[model samples]
Target: MRAIVVSEPGGPEVLEWREVPEPRPTRGEVLIEVTAAGVNRADLMQRQGLYPPPPGVSEIPGLECSGVVAEVGEDVEGFAPGDEVCALLAGGGYAERVAVPWEQVLPAPSGVTLAEAAGLPEVVCTVWSNVFMAGRLRRGETLLVHGGASGIGTCAIQMAKAFGSRVVVTAGTPEKIAYCLELGADEAINHREEDFAEKVTADVILDIMGAKYLGRNVSALNTGGRLVVIGLQGGLRGELDLGALMARRGSIISTGLRNRPVADKGVIVRGVLENVWPLVAAGAVLPIVHEVVPMADAARAHRILESGDHIGKVLLAR
Candidate 1:
């Protein structure tokens, strides 16, 4: 088996494809022959030595993947060998084979290909967990998402709209803003040119920039708003005005999926399969892939994701 190995922590050049021992399924796990892996910002962070995989997890960097099941471990009953599936993984999606717990695995949606399905898990699980489950974005209320053209942002826009929520997004480019609008975002703001804090008030805010947008996010919140911060692309430290948040009756939540326990991830995965899967199958939402690079050429995929120019998911296809 071959997987993308980090020679050392640095740039995209650090990612190398090399032969490695094949993984086998363990108790309650499933072994998958990887078809494609979704490239995410977290993978880049891992390559730069910022975020390492959880204990006892693979070193390879990938958060989601789609493939055929090669084998099933003891107690894995919902899946069988040869079943087509996609999984939300903590790590190791960059390899040709990965063993993961069955609870995080989901049957490929009826209308999407295995390659496309690879892009679904991470974005869907993240959006459903943060924007809906944590932020409590309800129908008729506006949901603001930073990085509106990103893989998670694209998925968030469509999923929120499908669930009857009004979606508002902030993107750096006009092209990205237009793309978000086409995906059903009711409002699109160019963060480069406009201050979103003055323009819109939202019931829920899904923010990626941590310290950079903290003040503005609180300012943009509507009464009793939930502000969910899922990524820290911006600087870590930020001055929080608890007075403003209290005045607006707003709350801030910080969450991440990678370090969560298996049972917690399973709960989010089940929610996605039950709720978001139907939207994908019905064409109300889709995995918006920007490009699919070869598995062996994962370095190129990392470059694409780190560029911040590509809209939607970038996949490394085997």
Candidate 2:
């Protein structure tokens, strides 16, 4: 099997395509013939030596993929060879084949293409767990999402709206903001030109910029607001006004999917499959794919994700 491997930390150029042994399914796992994999910020961070795979996991960088099952291991049931599925991988997705836990795999929604389904797992699990489960965004509440044109951002915007929440978003430019609005954001602000804290009212904030937006996020929140920081695209350190948080009775939460216990991710995967898969199959929620590059061009896919110009998910097709 051909896989993308990084021998040393660097840039996208560090990704090397080479032949590697095919992975076999272990107990409760399934071997998949990879069809496509989603490119994520975590992959770039791993390439740059900022993030490492969890202990006992594959060192490959990809985090989500869609494919057909090749074989099922002992204790794995309800899935068989030739089943069309997409999975949230902890690691090792940038290959022609991978072994994924059965708990992390879900049947691909009808009407979704294999390449597009590759883009679903990470964003879906992240948004549902953080925004709805953790952040407690509720109907009629105002929700703000940073990086509105991003894969997670787009998914968050749609799901929040679909659940009757008023969604607002911030993006780098007017074009990106417009794209966010097109994807169901009720309000879209150009972070480059506008002070979102002063212009918009938010009951909950789904932030990707972390330190860069911390102060403004605190200022923008309504009373009892929940602020969930999921990424650190900007610098990771910044000043926070504890006074503002206390006055508003706001709460701050942060989490990352990678490096978490497999049991925890498995629970999230099962919850998402039960709660959100119906929305996907019904065409109410969809994976937004910006580009699809061949697996051998994994370096190009990484470049596109790191460029910050893509409006949605970038996929590497096997």
Candidate 3:
């Protein structure tokens, strides 16, 4: 088997595709022959030696993938050899083969291809869990998404629209903003030119720029707003104003997908399969793929993502 390994962790140049021993299924796990994997910002962080894989996990740097199950470990149920599935992973999706807990796997949605399905797990689970489950966004409310052209942002826009909520988004370029509007964002703000805090207020804000946007994000909130921070592309430290937050009765939360326990991930995965899968199958929401590069060209994929030149998900195909 071959996987993308971080050769000393510095830049996209550090990612190398090399031969490695194939992984086998463990208890309640399934061995998958990966067909495709989604490239994420976290993978870039891993390459830069910022976000290491969880202790005892694979060294490869992918968070989600689509594949065919080659074997099922003892005690795993409802999945067998030859099952076509997509899964959420803590690591190792960059490889041609990986072993993932059965709880994180789901059959490919009825309408999406196997390769495209690879892009769904991470974005879908992240959006569904954060926007709906934690942020508590509901119909008739306004939801704000930062990096609206991103894989998670694109999915968040569509999911909010499907739930009958008004969606607002921030993007760096006009073309990217247009793309988010096409996907269902009611309003698009150019983060480069506009102060989102003054343009509009939201009942919920899904932010990626953590520290840099914290103050403005709090200011942009409507009364009773829920602010969920899922990424820290800007920096780690921020000043919080308790006085302003208290006046609005707002709540701020920060979360990460990796490093979570398997059972916790399972709960989120099950919520996605039951509540979000139908929307995907019906085309109310869909995987937004920017490009699909071969597995061997993963370094190039990482460059595209790190440059922030592409919109939506960049998939690495096996």
- Cα RMSD, model 3: 0.7
| Runs of candidate 1 exceeding 4 Å displacement | none
Least accurate 10 contiguous residues by lDDT in model 1: 300-309
Candidate 3 residues lying further than 4 Å off, grouped into runs, are none
Error of 3 at 312 (Å): 0.4
Q: lDDT values of the candidates? A: 0.94, 0.90, 0.93
Q: List the residue pairs that clash in candidate 3.
A: none
* lDDT tens per residue, model 3, 1-318: 889988897978888899999998999999999999999999988888988999999999999999999999999978999999999999999999999999999998988999999999999999988999899999999999999999999999989999999999999998998999888899999989999999999999999999999999999999999999998888899999999999999999888889889999999999999999999999998999999999889989988898888999999998
Candidate 2 local lDDT, 163-230, one digit each (tens): 89999998997789888988889989888888999998788899988998899999999999999999
Return the candidate ranking by lDDT, descending.
1, 3, 2
Clashes of each: 0, 0, 0
Give stretches of model 2 more than 4 Å off: none
